[model samples]
Target: MGDRWHIEVDRSICIGSGMCVGHAPDGFDLDSARQSHARATTADANEKLLAAAENCPVEAITLRLADSGETVFPPED
Candidate 1:
């Protein structure tokens, strides 16, 4: 199984509020332009990633296991 997790965001739904970056700065960043969208540049899966996905106001972010293509959310406690 791959150790990395992939993050995908729907740019059409993203409002560019910077919440994802604020929650997981290492995994996501917002482009500074008109109709900007947050982009996922890293594939690090951790509690922080889960937090960022959950904190997204528009629920634009999707998290998946890179190897198995399984969704990982509402993280295990």
Candidate 2:
């Protein structure tokens, strides 16, 4: 089995840019309020999803290791 990732979007930070959807349409979507949200809370590790997280202008998208809870996107600094 490969790694699984847990995805989250901080609505407080999301600007509804739709950048994530543009990068990975299947991974994210905008709500009626125009906030971005994950299509699934957890998913198989995939590059497109990573790009979606990386491209989020507000850094609202977050990806973490499902089993370990390790940060994947925005780096842990």
**C-alpha lDDT of all candidate models, in order:** 0.72, 0.94
Ten-residue region with minimum lDDT total, candidate 1: 33-42
TM-scores of the candidates are 0.76, 0.96
Local lDDT at 31 for model 1:
75
lDDT of 1: 0.72
Model 1 deviation from native, Cα RMSD in Å:
3.8
Candidate with best TM-score: 2
Candidate 2: residue 27 Cα off by (Å): 0.8
The reply for model 1, stretches above 4 Å from the true place, is 34-42, 74-77
1-77, model 2: which lDDT tens digit per residue?
99999999999989999999999999899999999999999999999999999888889988999999999997997
lDDT of 1 by residue, 1-77 (tens): 34677777888888877787888777777776422233554476787788888998888888878878777753555
